[model samples]
Target chain A: AQRVTQPEKLLSVFKGAPVELKCNYSYSGSPELFWYVQYSRQRLQLLLRHISRESIKGFTADLNKGETSFHLKKPFAQEEDSAMYYCALSLTGGGNKLTFGTGTQLKVEL
Target chain B: DVKVTQSSRYLVKRTGEKVFLECVQDMDHENMFWYRQDPGLGLRLIYFSYDVKMKEKGDIPEGYSVSREKKERFSLILESASTNQTSMYLCASSSPIRPARGGYTFGSGTRLTVV
Candidate 1:
């Protein structure tokens, strides 16, 4: 079974500090990876996709095939960056069906 | 902008009552999904449909059923609402067109409370 694991339940960082949220996946074949974010009282939206390799809101993630990790990174955190982050995986050409991880709550403190 | 709209923003129901959650997408996406979001569990997929009247069981599909009568509408049904079923329900839609750029569009979500 394909599974996505987000190691941290909560990550607290001061504003302007670097942020890294860990994510690892177990899949036999090649997979498409994604990062999704949900702000307070807002809908879940796509942050970045490995296939696209485009950064959103200063957040970027690189898919590590060897380590099977796709950790989200931000050079400097902002107060508004605090939200619940999810790591998701989908089989290549699987028709957009995704398997999401447990998620990590990122709290950016001022 | 393309949109996925869920019927209710919030709902309260008694235990053992049947519950229906409706989802509609205006983007004409080919796939629609139903997920339940809990504090620690994140978003667990309950069901998904790739085409009209075609439903697929997701990772956690027990106690939940789905209906996709039309291409734009997908309905999630809880056979009998239970306290454990109380959570924020999310609806999402996606398509093969521009899959990389447009990953998925999600609804605002429905917060369901079963007491």
Candidate 2:
């Protein structure tokens, strides 16, 4: 079975501190990984995808196939960065169904 | 700009009552999905449609049904609403025409409550 796992349920960090949200997956074939963020009173939106390899909002995630991980990281955490982050994996076959992790709540305090 | 809209921002329905949650997208995307977002569980797919009148069962579709009469509209129906079904329902759309970009545009979402 395909699954995505986010180790932390809540991650608190002071402003300007580095942040890392760990994500791991289990799949036999290649998978497409994504990071989605949902802020307070806001809709869930796509933050970034491993395919593009582009950084969004100062955050970057690298897909390590050998490690079966796609960890999201930021050099300096900002107050505005606080939100519920979900790590998702998309199966390349059959419409690319997405299986999301439980999610990690990042609280960046001043 | 691509936009997906759900019919209601919040809905309260009694258990055993039938419920309908409508979603429309103006992007004319070929794929539309209905998912329920829950705390600590993330989003779970309930149903999806690839084209008009075509539907597919997702990971969790036991008590749910869907309709896609038109290209831009998709509807989720709960034959008998249960307290367990109360959740944040989200609608999303993506252009299957472009397989390179795995991006999905989501709606604001509807908070459904069962009494």
Candidate 3:
């Protein structure tokens, strides 16, 4: 069974502090991982994908196949960055159907 | 811009009542999905449609049915709404471009409460 796991239910950091949201998966094949964020009262949106190897909103996630991880990281946390973040994986041979992990709620405090 | 729209932001229905939740996408996406979100469970797929009139069962398709009569619309129906069915229903659509990099465009989500 393929599963995605977000170990942290809540992560808190002071403003300007570095933040890391952990994500791990259990799959038998190559993985395609993504980070999605949902702001208060806003629609869920993609933050970054490992395949892109690019940062969005100063956030980056690297897919570590050896460890089966794709942790999201940011150098400096901002108040506006506080939101519920989810890690998702598409099935290997499916029509883009996603399997999401229980999200991690990140709070950037002052 | 990819635009996905849900029919309602909030809804209330009585137990055993028939319910319908509609979603539409303007981006001509080839794939559309319905998911129910809970506090700690994140999002669980209910059903998905790859094209008009084509439907597939997702991870959690029990107690839910879906329809896709046209290219832009997908509907989720509950034959008999139950309290456990109360959740945030999210609709997502995405094109098949760059399968690895393609991220889904989600709607604002519908908060349904079954009494």
Off by over 4 Å in 1: none
For residues B7-101, write the lDDT of model 3, one tens digit per residue: 99999999999999999999889899999999989999999988999999988998999999999999999999999999999999998768433
- lDDT, each prediction: 0.92, 0.92, 0.91
Q: Which 10-residue window in model 3 chain A sums to the lowest lDDT?
A: A90-99
Which residue pairs show collisions in model 1? none
Candidate 1: true interface contacts recovered = 0.76
Ranking by DockQ: 3, 2, 1
User: In model 3, which regions exceed 4 Å deviation?
Assistant: B99-101
The digit string of per-residue lDDT tens for model 3 on A10-103 reads: 9999999999999999998876789999999899998888878998999998999989999999999999999999999976665577889999
What would the per-residue lDDT of candidate 2 be over residues A1-110, giving only the tens digit for each residue? 89999989999999999999999999989899999999999888889999889999999999999999999999999999999999998887657567889999999999
Output the worst ten-in-a-row residue range by lDDT, candidate 3 chain B: B93-102
Error of 3 at B34 (Å): 0.4
lDDT (tens digit, per residue) of candidate 2 on B1-115? 5399999999999999999999999987888999999998899999998899999999999999999999999999999999999999999888765443357888999999999
Candidate 2 residue-wise lDDT at B42:
90
TM-score of 3: 0.97
Fraction of native contacts, model 3? 0.74
Ranking by TM-score: 3, 2, 1
